[model samples]
Target: SQQGEEDPQALSIQEGENATMNCSYKTSINNLQWYRQNSGRGLVHLILIRSNEREKHSGRLRVTLDTSKKSSSLLITASRAADTASYFCATDAGAGNQFYFGTGTSLTVIP
Candidate 1:
């Protein structure tokens, strides 16, 4: 299957703290992308790391990929209340117009 699955379906952390989530997939992929959704807002892309990449970072977010294990991890450092949202991991199947996403991890950054 192309779908990725993330651990810790939910998490709650204090503002200024850090949160981490992991994702695992079953098929080969061209790239993996992370997205964040706040309440009813549309998802916003956080970062995309190609299959050839091992690690990538954007602002306070860091992502690591282990192709051998078909797994990836996302780390949010110094998270704020504004960071409260649902995070999802998506994989491009390398085929045209094909992508799959995980169920998502619900995060609440408490102030």
Candidate 2:
């Protein structure tokens, strides 16, 4: 895996359902973050998980990190139409404070 490699190129789901995505990284990271973008626009930070942490959640979003495997996953529960967006995982190596983003997963939520 590269610095950021998200699985599932695209996804389609109905409102009220759940959407899950995965990401794998190459080198060790200081922290991992998840972001969302709508309509090919700017990205919104969703959650951030430090290498020392295992899992974190905010509202309907849950993020998990497995440093041993160098992987992470994001789960959106009770997904809404507004949840339809591109999801990306980013890694921060703590080197110059730069973040590298993944390929991204396009999610479509039908209402």
Candidate 3:
């Protein structure tokens, strides 16, 4: 169980359905980040929630962090076909500006 390593390596959902993914990490962190990457493009920042924060939201994206459980979850509501992409979670340990990334979740929103 390394830092920022999470589950559900892949996910598939229909358009208009919601999608959820989880991320877990070890040790203390300053903030957790979620990113989305298209097939061959770079990652796009989704959201970042601080350690002191329980949850945050941006548009159709909702993020929750529980330091007690050392885990975080991302929820995308009313998903769309254009939302199809691989999502990765990142954690900034706040130590020397280092960040750890999760394996990533491949999401396919079928029309």
TM-score of model 1 (CA atoms): 0.96
Q: List model 2 lDDT by residue over 2-105, tens digit each.
A: 46989888999999999999999988999999999998599999999999999999999999999999999999999999899999999988573788899999
C-alpha lDDT values of all predictions: 0.93, 0.92, 0.91
lDDT of 3 by residue, 13-63 (tens): 999999999999988888999999999999899899999999999999999
Across 23-102, the per-residue lDDT of candidate 1 in tens digits comes to: 99998889999999998999999999999999999999999999999999999999998899999999987663877999
**Higher-ranked by lDDT: 2 or 3:** 2
The candidate maximizing TM-score is 1
Please estimate how well model 1 matches the true structure, expressed as its whole-model Cα lDDT.
0.93
How many clashing pairs in candidate 2? 0
Those runs of model 3 whose alpha carbons end farther than 4 Å from true positions after fitting are: none
TM-score of 3: 0.95
How far in Å is the alpha carbon of 57 misplaced in model 3? 0.7
What is the Cα-based lDDT of residue 11 in candidate 1? 96
